[model samples]
Target chain A: EADIYQTPRYLVIGTGKKITLECSQTMGHDKMYWYQQDPGMELHLIHYSYGVNSTEKGDLSSESTVSRIRTEHFPLTLESARPSHTSQYLCASSSSDRNTEAFFGQGTRLTVV
Target chain B: AQSVSQHNHHVILSEAASLELGCNYSYGGTVNLFWYVQYPGQHLQLLLKYFSGDPLVKGIKGFEAEFIKSKFSFNLRKPSVQWSDTAEYFCAVDIMNRDDKIIFGKGTRLHILP
Candidate 1:
């Protein structure tokens, strides 16, 4: 089984609230990523970290930011959540090897009302 | 910019029917391709992947995909599909050494008739 985990499987919060989606992986992977996906839609890359203390914005622009303080933890924070931010957030991790597959978390579904 | 494309938005098939899903990428150089499946209310999981060697890669649940480099396509196929196979399938591409991001297609929702 994949060791990645995300907190708050489901969340309903008021708009403008600052929220942080937690993601942690016990696989000791060097490549970690966060993707945003809507119901029945495609997954859009939002943030990724190559290694500890190295984070980069993904192809899709996102208002949220992520920090990789430790290899096992990567958290995404939304300064002020909006209705547009209501979507499922998925976390994934993979080894640095080019041939390896990524392991994914269960995902956190957020609802901003 | 590189992109992944899934030609079929949704597909409906009966049990024991042959299935095929088309996927194409717009990268010319070496790439690592993957197929991921997400069953209803479940997390995404790796169905299969192709990094090198044989182009025909078999995955879990009796699914397989062939990587045709000349056509820039990696199409997924299954001889006989079951109801448990109902899920959303995503095709992902990683452009080797050019970028660290893994781009995914819009995904095709597969529905199997019981």
Candidate 2:
């Protein structure tokens, strides 16, 4: 079973509102990532953390910010929501071993009106 | 940046029919290939991966893929597909040892007629 979990499986908010998507894992993995995907589209990595307190931007630029204080939690926050922010946010966690498979969460679909 | 391509956006097939989905990637350096499946309302799950070994690799649920170095392709195939196989399949590529970053294709949606 996948140890990763994302909260608020679905969310709807108004524009200009601040929001955060919660992500947690119980696998004790060192690597965590957040990806954004639209309906039936490719996934784009937006943020990643190699370890606690080490966050980096991914290939895709994103307006969301993430923080990793503990190994299990990695939350993505949007200062101000916009219509374009509507998409599915997926959280994944992986161990330190090379070629190790990643575990993904159920994903949180957010819609900003 | 490396990119993956899924030639077929959608495919329809009958039960017990053969299935093949083409995948190609553009990366000059050594890379790892993988196939992931997502059933309806389910999260994505790894089907199989090609790290280093024989070109042909088999995955769970009667799925297999052949990695062609020259063509930079890793196509997924199943001799006979069941109705339960109806889902979206994605091909992903990551640089060797760089498990943190993986480039994914748009994914192919397969529909099996019962």
For lDDT, the strongest prediction is 1
lDDT tens per residue, model 1, B1-114:
899999999999999999999999998899999999999999999999999999999999999999999999999999999999999999999878646678899999999999
Q: Name the TM-score of chain A in model 1.
A: 0.98
Docking class of 2: medium
Off by over 4 Å in 1: none
Candidate 2, position B15, lDDT? 100
Candidate 1 CAPRI grade: high
What pairs collide in candidate 2? none
Worst 10 residues of 1 chain B by lDDT: B94-103
Local error of candidate 2 at A89, Å?
0.7
**For every model shown, what is its TM-score relative to the native structure?**
0.99, 0.95
User: Judged by TM-score, which candidate is best?
Assistant: 1
lDDT of all predictions = 0.95, 0.91
Each prediction's fraction of true contacts recovered: 0.91, 0.56
Candidate 2 displacement at residue A101 in angstroms: 1.6
Error of 2 at A15 (Å): 1.3
Compared with the true structure, what per-residue lDDT tens digits does model 1 show for residues A1-113?
99999998999999999999999999999999999999999999999999999999998899999999999999999999999999999999999987888889999999999
lDDT string, candidate 2, B12-102, tens digits: 9999999999999988778878999999999999999998889999999999999999999999999999999999999988766454577
